[model samples]
Target: MSQSATTTQNPRNPDRHQGLANGGTTFAGVLLAVTGLLSIFRGIMGIAKNDVFVATKDYVFRWDLTGWGWMHLILGLLVFLVGLALLKAAPAWARTAGVVLASLALIVNFLSLPWHPLWSLILVALYAFIIWALCTVKRGHT
Candidate 1:
């Protein structure tokens, strides 16, 4: 068989495409970890009733600060773990997990916009970058 046919036929061929370089993956991993850490800190602040966050009145998405705190804490932990995983020689599943977690983080930060407008906006942008980086990998590149 020709080289091309042989490579195509072998599912586990090393010549198979593996999307994204080590650098890109590493960047995404670092970003995820940092973002996750920030979220965790934000969660703790919210839970502790820190005066840093402004109280919003009459907002449609109004949720108890404590409730949001717990939400962020749990979600942040998950994201952080996923980020750690990505830092290693992550598998395909890790990439998918990273994308999912980043998207969730973006939503969570958006919901928190009223409390800390600038910080929330920054996080939203960061998460967007993480999502983009994770999703930019071509299919076939591991």
Candidate 2:
């Protein structure tokens, strides 16, 4: 058989073919999805107890807790959508957006740590993982 015939007949290797050329992107996408869900849950909780939570320990800031809750809700929704897109083979821009959003989440959670210290810490850590996963793609492999 000619080289062209073999190349066209079996272009891909079933055993080696993965969803993404680099596994880091897939892992990062999964992390973003999970974290987005968590953010949605947390935002709902925040909105549910906006007043009491805000009143506790004089944690009131310039913006209302409910407003913050809304911000988180919107951000979470966007992140979840982007993550789904990433899983569905979105373009490189989507992946880059994920990284930027995750970084923003990290900063937001960090600044809000005083309100819910433990949960904020958890989110910060998760965001750190996301950033790491997104940034640590295999060099020269993709």
Candidate 3:
């Protein structure tokens, strides 16, 4: 068969492939944005010295609540910006940034377990999903 014939028969043009990829990217972007916002709120709570969180004493990874708060606030802002970028344009760099930020968020959440176990776990799960979504997209297919 001719190469042109094969290409035409496949019915998977770049547009269609990109559309398929966009679906996943869009979902990931939304999830990342939501997660970032949540992180920001958590950071604010901590920075404000709100009584919402309780840190376990003598936890090996323990950090000053305010310090963690600052970390979350900054990380959350970065995540939020990357998420927005992905939503607007699913560029390769955006995907990379998403994965990196998601990984960082996962680590932060893990360390935060002692402060808020349930919430931290939930964020951890969300970050994992974001990472999966970002990584699963085939390179050059997007």
Count of backbone clashes, every candidate in sequence: 4, 0, 0
Instruction: Compare the candidates by lDDT and give the number of the best one.
Output: 3
Q: Candidate 2 at residue 106, lDDT?
A: 89
- Per-residue alpha-carbon lDDT of candidate 1 for residues 5-104, written as tens digits (9 for 90 to 100): 9887787754443333345677889888887787788789889985757888877798888888888888888888889998885888998999898898
- Could you tell me every candidate's TM-score relative to the true structure? 0.80, 0.72, 0.81
Off by over 4 Å in 2: 1-21, 51-61, 139-142
lDDT of 3 by residue, 95-120 (tens): 99999999999999999898889888
Candidate 3 stretches greater than 4 Å from native: 1-22
Clashing pairs in 1: 17-140, 18-141, 18-142, 19-141
Q: Candidate 1, residue 81: CA error in Å? A: 0.8
- Specify the poorest-scoring 10-residue window by lDDT in model 1: 14-23
Regarding TM-score, does 1 or 3 come out ahead?
Answer: 3
Which candidate wins on TM-score?
3
How do the residues 37-59 of candidate 2 rate in per-residue lDDT, one tens digit apiece? 87787778778888545434555
